[model samples]
Target: MDPLPFLLQPPVFYPIIPYACTIFGGLRPGRMILIQGSAGISATRFQIDFQCGCSTRPRSDIAFHFNPRFSSSDAHVICNTLRKDHWLDELKFSGAPLKKGETFVLLFLFLPDKVKVSIGGHHFLDFTYRLPLKDVDAVGLYGDVTIKELSFLSSNPLKSGSADLQKTPLSKTFPMGLSECQVIAVRGLVTANPDELTLQLKSSDSIPFKLTANFQDQTLSYNSFISQSWGQPQNVQTPFFLFYPERFFEILLLPEAGLFKLAINGTPVNDYRPLVFDLKSIEELQITGSAGLFVVQC
Candidate 1:
């Protein structure tokens, strides 16, 4: 039997400059491949490829190539496809989201329309699937850099049957809050035996608000950790059960007029005051722990 999507062994971390990993059973819709590493300070270029196979005595079939080149004064990303040893017209993007010597998170999120790439939690580029995604299997990386981590997992998780949607328990970072009166929503199915689920609007300095769910008591708690201190945990007991395993649900967070209003499955739950002031300080939206999250939108 094939390995579970989340349980697939991560590719061996490569300290050297070049490496490759076989992506068994191919890619699928609503899947993501995460690559974490740092580019060399003196490096000029690096490339990652989704290929048909890794055989290249003559040349292999490269389904998609994402390459970043920094040649002294010029920096850009090159995208193309290779078939039967012939290269197609190059599509060059003008921005390089990563610096030469900085650690970065590179996410390739596969949705139905396109494969969206993000750098440092910001959307960078989009490439349409010119062919069936399942036609590509292996992932190869080469050029001047070190690979800290590499893994592939499902992006959209199902209820009951797909508890192991993420191998090491999913911890995802998303963007949030365009203005003071902002709304954030998450659509997901909770795990059957979830010990904890934590969602936070955070920044490098402080967390404006945090939502914590403890399944053992079927209780929802809200708190804030600011200025090197943990605030009081206010239990929310309204609108009955806000969490139910084996069921699809929607949760929304709306911030306005010095209060944060929360709703579950489109039902009004409660409103609470801010524990930490200055909502503009919150720049990151993060979800961590054993929750089968499907969609998170701001």
Candidate 2:
């Protein structure tokens, strides 16, 4: 039910920051401006949260009114309901001009866990949390905000490919110490239909793997996904999130025998990719971005 945990996981790329490049673009409550009434919302509860902010704002809270007729104190500000203060340690900002125009860059970073921010070379803040990827939310911008360039540096670097394994096939290189491994590449515009998917991989290793959705017990369901060793499933914030061989691999749904197909970097995979014998659901098959960066899709 809660998206906080999934949101906390570290992302290979920074989430979107609204109006990242414009004359007046920054984190605002809503597109216009969020105001608090006498007895309803208050500035403390509402905010113009950057990528990250400390516990308090002194000079002027990021939230402001857009009516152009009201003072900041009298106006309402939207606030983040999510709790991530402990994970975020430093905040940074830059008013530098854009690369080719009059735009500006407003950058913020949540240190410790991961880095989620943008700006020029000044480099104001450092993320403090350890693998804090789930706490990120949509960027908000209100009155008079402009940003040109946005960049972020993560404290923890994500690993991709078998670079660690010297690009060795999972089945061949991984011996006894190896637990299990599976890689797949699937392509085609995703739809609600189960028959529209095909998957393939290259692995002679007999390791058992499962194909599933990003979220658990919802969206797409299948009866073919089989688990090699259930073991003690780790406790994740998301519902039905089960652990697989890869540390980053979090499966929620499974694919049926005929509904989904497989391949490996464009090559036809017959025995390398695992086959499904049971039913499992796939809310979504993540194959790009941070989740996709590690997974090759064709």
Candidate 3:
């Protein structure tokens, strides 16, 4: 194979200041290029070392040469050498383990003097240099890694609200209880139907309070609302309030009549930005039983 090209004279300087950062240039797996010998940039020995010229090195620099074919096990990693002649004595930095077919997310947080690297929610490293790190600078990556999104978060980040939100279904059933009157709020579609819903409310007692609404007359009608005590079911359209531990239950409403806002259990959501669809239209509605069994798996 032909020898890799080299710069004639490499300077010695650091490209980053104490807190500045450069976001990765498109170095994701899709646009990854195998690196060999002194990745084009002149090596700076200190902060003030200017780029002398394109220079080649025999030992102090890293080679980006890849095998003729792709191999996950043989990819290059980021390394730091003490001297230009001691490549074998280099120190390698490993980020999170790169698994084949696994997609990764990279975030660069630039502070006044340092840069923080976050990979898949796991913090990788903080880079501090003697000079300013320019944008679109090349970092390091290897095999079996796919980049999903490369983002630069300023003081005000630009991202969807759902990016950091996660929801997990309740695994255990909750006992019967009443909700505080202050909790009910109306937003999306709410209706009266027992056949299409199963709710488990818990109070101070160990037994979960069970209530199911059956839609008989094409509308879901229920006079009973959850409270702290084993109270009497009253005839009311809105939720009545009482002190309770917390309300824990799952409801599956029809596609047309969406999720009932649990904020207060009554009038429609009005405080903040509303979602386009309160309840997603799914084929099945599922809930776990008290014993952790699939109680209502639709």
Candidate 4:
């Protein structure tokens, strides 16, 4: 039930058929692709492909091929791979939910070992990797479909190396303290029916930034604790409820000039000015909540 990452990339709206685009940063675990479109009224078939490249003469290898075919008698979904212009063993599933002239939301969540496919907010199937996921660099859509929007959501903010994957109620200290350019990225899944999730940047005697996700109220609030007491809380109602129960989320905190910028998923959510001025004094990061932590990178 993780919410789809929206507005991460410049959405491709109403693109011409047979669309193909390079996936920036390539495919990785925890990344998701969301597509919103409708099938053509007279359409017989359509396909979504994750390809190694965009080559056509030799036909670039397809890591995952998700095709839905609508026949007079049978309507099913076929998943397979294409390598060296040859099709691999096909895996077919019955009862494809897609219908002609109906708008649908398609989500592909990339995990470590398999790709989870969801259509119209419902779980469909999991496609195991026949080809390595690291090789997928592009995505394509072909045949009778009209795409309203296509978006890519990245859970990790670190670009060069692996991040520390850990559990929640985590408390880590930094001897060198924080810097102006530091970015702390936290990715996790909220527990079912979570009450509250808190993330704090703390110093020896003060907390410069503390972010709280109030599930019951569906609000994101922030405040600072400098004089042994909390400041007036600033809350923002997230209409989309980014941190729903049992939903995956990614939060990024970047230290700017005089404020800290917070982004959920890939969208910038808020900027909070801190009561404490010294960035170096912020030596600890603490997270306590009802969520499973995946990646924590500073």
Candidate 5:
């Protein structure tokens, strides 16, 4: 038998928090979800849950409960599964990645054994499965959050034990390819007068490739920390990065032998030496500020 085809669902635009949206056909063994939003200035804690239903009085079972608490010095993310009428042992991760007043990209990649949570584009951590995914009929959000976008789309089969990056012809991998550049592309909207958009590739807690787009000063920088101390920042002029709010754009990055070439739309943009030579260690990609996420393809 063949794998299930990718399913595309209409995204929910800017919605009020404490929201719950139904999963059209529940969920499959392999499903991908994108939640785009920012932490409110007064946000100290927030919770996102994948539950069997939206019942209240007689609380329904929750497949995955993601709670991020920033009220204490030791901020942590608590993950748990609610079965029957009791909650399971909580998995708490210290050092929360979310800023109280900054925008973030939360990507949830569901696999057979775990649900991979990527903050921005970089991998955050993985939560082992406790409840059957097929029972998850709703995605709910509550607490101090300003949701910008929330949607689901299925495409490409994931390789076992990692985020899926199908190695095929560029044409087949990306439909919007201008000239068959087998690189990573990010298409999204921009905010006004932003600082920078950063993407970090990390293994465990170590970052290999750190790509930063500075909009306030019109500069692009690349830095790496494959070992211990951070490397010197490689900066270049990118006056084209400045833009008004909600403008559509695409950024393409091709990692050649020694250099990583970047482009805006179809035009050339910038280039820098790749700090990360070992590709397998980069498990996460982090994208923050300056831009909204359309897609992150590797």
Candidate 6:
């Protein structure tokens, strides 16, 4: 929520073409690689490689090879692995979102089993690893692309070694209580047939705010529990549904100026003014739902 920390390495700006650099901490789940650049007007193809090492004569292994090919009629992306100078089966994704001469922001989100790719802040495609992810130690970018910036974002702070969000009903306590300008981020994956998901900010004797995302009814509502009674529930009027089965999601709640601002997947949703006046009275955060959580950052 707070401008993702660059824990691995400092960002590189305006690097020369055919650049290759060591990945300080290697690849890990929850880490993200962000690239901002544009293709040349006559660009045909460019490749981004996650390699074991930078070897020339012997050619080090490539764990993931992401190649985007541009053409006059159609565009496509090819994903594969290179082991011992031999490429594995290539996976082709048609209708690539990339275009020659167009600037774009690319994001690669590393997960346990697959890598999620986003182009220009929109989900594009996924590439599963053929080689072990832990072996990837360097990254290489080649061909007719001008890179503006490149960075590696830190993984979830709450994550432990080989530990993911499998336990439910997760809760976190704030010793000094919450204050204004603080943000809470919750990221997870919706179950295939999720019914409902609830996130709450609780005080000693009451719930200052509770959000319920009902997938069954396709609605999002919020309320407060105070004085042994539940307040009137209010529905959030969103332009479109934000949650989907088998999809990843991020929820950000920021308390500011006597109200809470909410956002879903980088898009602002709505603000809600709570019944509780004392923001510092909120001491706990709780999440319970049918989704599989990846991280909860306060």
> What RMSD value applies to candidate 2?
15.8
How close is every model to the real structure, measured as TM-score? 0.51, 0.26, 0.24, 0.65, 0.53, 0.54
- For each candidate, the alpha-carbon lDDT, in order, equals 0.71, 0.26, 0.26, 0.81, 0.68, 0.82
How much does candidate 4 score in TM-score? 0.65
lDDT of 2 by residue, 1-298 (tens): 4532222121112213233212122322211111111211221221233332323333122221111112333322222223333322233223322222122233344433433333332333333333223333333433332322122211111223323222211112222222122222221112222221212121232223333333333322222233533222212233322221222321222223433333221222222223532112222222321122222221
Tens-place lDDT digits, model 5, residues 17-106: 789989888877667787778888777889899999999768889999999888645457899999987999999887767888889778
Error of 3 at 148 (Å): 3.3
Q: Tell me which residue pairs clash in candidate 4.
A: none
Q: Determine the C-alpha RMSD for candidate 1 after optimal superposition of all C-alphas.
A: 17.0
> Is candidate 3 or 4 superior in lDDT?
4
The lDDT, on a scale of 0 to 1, for candidate 6 is 0.82
Q: lDDT (0-100) at residue 68 of candidate 4? A: 92
Q: TM-score for candidate 6, please give it.
A: 0.54
How well does candidate 2 match the true structure in TM-score terms? 0.26
- Predictions ranked by TM-score, top down? 4, 6, 5, 1, 2, 3
* Residue 101 in candidate 3, Cα distance off native in Å: 1.6
Provide the global lDDT of candidate 2 against the true structure. Answer: 0.26
- For candidate 3, write residues 188-248 as lDDT tens digits: 1112122333343322322122333333322222222223333343221333221111111
Candidate 4 structure quality by residue, lDDT tens digits, 90-179: 999988788888888888899999999888768899999999999999999999999976767564212113253356789878899888
State the lDDT of candidate 1 residue by residue for 210-235, as single tens digits. Answer: 88877778788888878878788888
Best-fitting candidate, scored by TM-score: 4
